[model samples]
Target: MIALTLRQRNIIEYLLSRDSYVTNDVIASNFEVSNRTVRKDLEVISAYLKEQGISLVRKPGKGVWIEDKQEVLFDDLSCSYSKNERIVIYVTSLLLNDVNTFMTLASNCGVSKQTVINDLNTIEKFLDGYHLSLIKNQGVGTSLEGDETDIRRLFIDLLFTNDHSKIVYELCINNDGIQRNLDVSFELITVIENEFRFRYVDRDRISIVLSFLLNRLGLMKTKNSTIQSSDMERINSILSTKISDSNDQEYISSFLLGERVEGSLTLDSKVEDEANEISEHLISSLKKIHYFDSEDMKDIIRSLTVHVRAAIYRCRNNIHIRNELDEQVRFAIGVMYEFTKKELNVYETKYNLNFDQSEISYIALYLASIFETGVQEDLKVVIMIVCTFGLATSSILKSRMYQIFGDCFIVGPYSIEEAEKYLESHEVDLIISTNYMSVKSTNVIYINPLLKQNDIEMIRNTLFQESFMKMCSLFFNKNKVVEHDYHCLGEYISKNDVSISKGKISWEDAIRKAAAPLVAKGDIENKYVNTMIQAVNEFGTYMVITPKVAYVHAGKDDGVNKNCVSLLLLENEIPFGSFNTKPVIAIVVLGICDKEESQLLNIANILDIPENIELLKNSKNIESILSLHD
Candidate 1:
């Protein structure tokens, strides 16, 4: 035979198995390799086949096929046995079947007469253990004789001496065939005859024959086997007269034949009593191990009942095996039932206590603590500006503070005494007192009643400086921005119109018209401008335009607190020279700020561009900006 690589051989074998030809593309796709590699492997196989007298032909654009052959040459190479060894076994078996003429037998097996004689000598050695003799006459064929029973028994023992005997015994017991004590190694003839008769008989007759044989033969001896004490008890209980008396034989036979057994009240009562006892014990043990709800417990009990009933039926019907073996089977069933019962108990207990009230309370507190630690430290300065009356100045201060600091939880407008009382028990991290009232201690930072843009800027810088960033890094890295800050900004843009409009106005005029009111109120200027510039540099380039309502004055009683701040992006930078306000082509400023204000201030800080504002107003493309919410 020509030598071939494993891959080439595999390819050849695959082609042989197919009835029709396969394309090279189909084979390449199936193997997930390049077509070139597959073709190279196939070429090797084709050359090897030709050398071995087999022709492999391929038709262009069609496929490959093997040429016709009178005999399968691969089969000769496939067999592991030598040609002489194969002939020896074939000749010997033929002779044993009563072929007398040596020349004819030799001719039939395709071997010379001398080879047949050589094989006969080897056969003589093969039959040594069987103690049988082969006699040959000059005119007649060879005959096998001498203790045929012993010879058959020797063959049977050889075939069944290992694992097959145990498998056959199990098969017989499970199928409700004749139950016999499988302990003895009887003569092969006896076993074969009995098996033949058993196969042809009815269920009752088979059962009777099995019972008689087991009783007559006695128990088989098992050595060094681990048989537990409880196993013995279970076997006794199953084979006891109360459960399997002779009077119940008919019903037992019916049950074994896969038919429902009825008729005997005594038998029915006994089986039911045993099943109920087992079911009750399983339920009680399961309950102790775990807490199962009523419905779940009931389902488990139903399953246990089915298992017990099946076990009882098997014990009653299986009479071919000895009482000891039957008890062992029942004991195994009992152990399995006990194991299931314990597991169900544990499951019930664990599931019932999953989310008790105390657990929920702990979870809520843990979540609150997580939120406290995760909020950006720079945004944590919660200032409440206290004034005599709840009016314009307080609102203006609030808006200005928000524009400077990204977030601040401001609580304000309380009287001096009211502020002191509220701060006594409430959490006030920082207090901004606008009025010159005598405050309690040094922890409070008092600013002038008329606040300036630089003052607010200094406060923001001091609050969220280097020390605060370090503190924030302890809980979370700088790469992870807070979701709530962005959420607040997006939500505010969604509810307001922050669009810019084209006009005959200079950028400085727009900035003054928008920012001048807040600036005059001691709220805007360099800090707000710098903060807006920083925001615009970080985000993309944008254009800004003046709003039509930019000139509207805001007051406490005007019922129109025009603290409107909008965001817009433009395609190009409109020509504006550097006069702080010139680069900022559009302007949006709040007249007054209050606690109930929306997110316009944050959006303005995020997108600080005059051209962008103009584009946004003209295009009304708020959806793209607002998509940050998702």
Candidate 2:
């Protein structure tokens, strides 16, 4: 008897999996071994194969291959499965089929009981991800423990790893349970698709049919799974099979009903009923949460009805949306996001449903779009420029301010005495003077006669602060006006608001380091950092708004002590998620105050400019970064 080591088996398996010859270097690299070791391994395998009338050929540049003309020897070797792969398959079979005993798994997988026990350790790790466990009891032998929905989702994920083609092939290809009945299911799908004038993704169509067949064959279990009586009768007539059990019709019925909503294509009775019910509750919840316009209430309700229907279908099926604009949308519509999530929570509680953050983010995106259309124009910042450098210089400064701020501010050039007189009568948001002024109002910024990039940043900060104060007054405090010294990006950067991460770090660590300066300054608490990280874990890299930049922020309610922004630059780029092609190099942690809100549009606008983004990514000094606005 011959015993093969795991490495030898892996080497042979790797070579066999490939159609062309594999280089010793590639094989060694894959297994993390030296090329010499790989060559030695090949030599040992070659010596053994020669005795069995098999040839191992090694071309100079092409690499190594097996040339067994009879194909008998290699075919035997191909049947050998890795212990780990066998374990996964064995556990999957146990979870899905009637094979529950340790003995059955061992026999089915051609492994020893001890080997199966060792494999269980690895299997436990895999099941832990789905919050599931593999338990072996004296009476029951072995069983899986988890929510039925989560367990099924885990099974599907393990089976197909997001590949729908493999799902169809595994469940429907020449299988005894579905081999005959699939034709009837196919006909049913065609009839339904045509009658409803709705299309189903081929993958989803096959899965629906497969779910029905598997449920019927007793290979899979669907908890509380059912179909309408009318649908059941129609399906039974089409198949001419007496589906005596009501449960037998449920899986197909739910799938069909879900498919109609998932596509958002058909407005049939079933979809309409589900959509209206969910949308009415959602809209009512939103209205209760905040004051909004009722002018386009019907249109808004209709849009929500269709969206919620689709969202419900997806949530149940564990389908996720990959929203690229999630971070930007969340940042821009900060309060609205919280409002939308709270409203969705109402629906979740009522229906016993779970909506992932991505779904909530999608809803927020739609709401933000609708809300933006009705945004009341901002009250322009009124500035009275007091220039010590006479009329010509003051006029130039005023013109430049107007050029830069555009509609954001109303700039007026005035002498120091004239500014005092104007301020006595008119309410000015800010005072920009060439020389230092002993003004009564604290809202004053001093800049040089020649406005530089740094000057624009300062002016932007002043205006942003004023806008934030207004928002705070409107939202939280209506009595006293909120006041705070305006801090520009340059001041923050120069005041050591930046943390440069040197080596490879996790996204969580990157965020923590980015926000550490603010945390140290009592701008935000530790809980806020954890909350931001948790949000990323739940919703993915929706925070990565642009390449090399991530606005890592959670809701204001999540431990925000004050409104602040800190920047962290990474020397080594780290991958965020599917959203960015380039790895993230900058993490801008935004700590938003619960009582006060800042307009992210200005920040977004500055970062939106490619040149500004480039400067932020490449610059090491505050001066270079400020030059971006110029």
Candidate 3:
């Protein structure tokens, strides 16, 4: 026997696998080695093959191939498995099969016998993670040396971690004995689903898994191993009735915990509590990317809570499943996905666990659906959305409603009849109905059943007016009213309540100077100016309403005596921060007496228009500026 190097054996096996001649480039790519290295390896391989009565045939301008006068030298290493796939095969074999010798495993995987030896080294490292070790005997075979339970757990863990897309091709591709076993396994799954009154999300994947397990039922290894699960006893009994082997039963029962049958998971108090806390955290984290607070959002909160509970159960049990939407979520909302991943580290650490990206990806997906709606607003408008369409369509409309509206509290995607009955008992601020309301209220808006783009446009405009009127109604009450030096945005300025600066000033100074007019007139105390400065320090240029203008204010108790507005018009727009891309041409300081909540909305409305903002920037005097708004 020639002492062949591992690469020589691999090159020989590679050539043996190919039916026709292969170029050095092809071999190089397969082995991830250079063509020069491959040529050298082939020289070594050729010597070894000659000793074995095999010839390494090289045809110029064609490629190199093995010429064997005899029959098949190797069982075709063409169907080579990737490292990950090989790892899965090793894990599966280690659990049930005893024929785990280097040569035997290599022959099965279509690689050099030495490749299996190298793979075993890697496999041993993986086993260490599960607190299991490989007991290998030289020139013989390897066996899993650990608790039966740990062995089973290692199997389950590896199965979920890898998709193993090709793991069951032989078993599933119409072989007689294996196909019969597959039929039994599939029937077992149906029985399990029926027994639990729930179905597997991916039934085909489960069938593949069960089929793999059934085919590997090696002539009764022993009844030594038991899978640790809350339903282990029940699973054993269930599998026992169908499967005869007590030890092999765990193979079927272990994956029983992987049953994620949507909304079917029952949460105990402790899990429920953790779920609640984590759900709130998830929402708070996502709110950074978008404004939230609605009935649909509440449903999201509940759905999120339930999902986290299931995910926690799955993680604690070391059961990870493939979420199909995982990649889609990570790509669609990459920012939210990354942010959620970072935010979830707190929960992971607090709980003393690591979460699979599949689990985190699911959370990201739920949040992405909400974030995708792109409805940015702070004021919450209560709306009763009545849809005559079916439940599925209404459910869709509700999602669409969230996508389009800001901070709205949706009452119901009720039928017209449901809305009428509800309206009698409960007072909603606005009624948005697909079917016209027979009750006929001033707040109601009718629309098409489809809820088209034009309907959204009309609905948004109506909602804006409704929100403004509702805000304006706040200051109409007498007790809510405060005696003020200036009654409105124009009046404060009409009576010596503004600043005009040439060139530029510090934003802090701009805010202070802007509020000076109101401060001097006693509409607000000097303390209000300091609060505005501190707020800007804390919240940045959030007050900068429309890129060109800023609205600065503190709480009314921050020494606001009167509801008033003041503006600092800077000739050269000054950037608020070192990195502030939007410069402030004007800073509108609002000093509100609690009743002037509508002022923010009003100023936003005026400055929101580019023409009005441009006019305000050019206004030289109080009268000219006041006239700009008018």
Candidate 1 Cα deviation (angstroms), residue 79: 9.6
Candidate 2 on 378-435: residue-level lDDT in tens? 3355677778787788778878987888766564677778777777778877788787
Instruction: Show pairs that collide, candidate 2.
Output: 226-250, 227-250
**C-alpha RMSD by candidate, in order:** 35.0, 17.2, 21.7
lDDT of 1: 0.41
User: How do all models score by TM-score?
Assistant: 0.20, 0.43, 0.40
Q: What is the C-alpha lDDT of each candidate?
A: 0.41, 0.60, 0.63
lDDT, candidate 1, 1-630, per-residue tens:
555543555567667766766656455535533455678767877777777678777875446766654433554432122344433334334322444566765654455778667777666665655676667777786665555333433333322232223322333343322333322212221342243232221333234333333332222221111222332333333333323443223322322321111221122334345555554554454334333453634543444454343334433432111121221111112122223333333333532312211112222232223323334453365666676636677677666666765566667756789888887777654566666666543124455455653355335433532223223222222212322344433555423444444555543344444454455445444355443333232211122212211111122222324444443332323433221111333344443333234333234333333343444445545465554331
Candidate 3 clashes between residue pairs 3 or more apart in a chain or in different chains: 373-403
Tell me how far the alpha carbon of residue 557 in candidate 2 is from the true structure, in angstroms, after superposition. 22
Better lDDT candidate (2, 3): 3
Candidate 3 residue lDDT tens string, 240-297: 7667776777655656554455444444446346767787787775555344664667
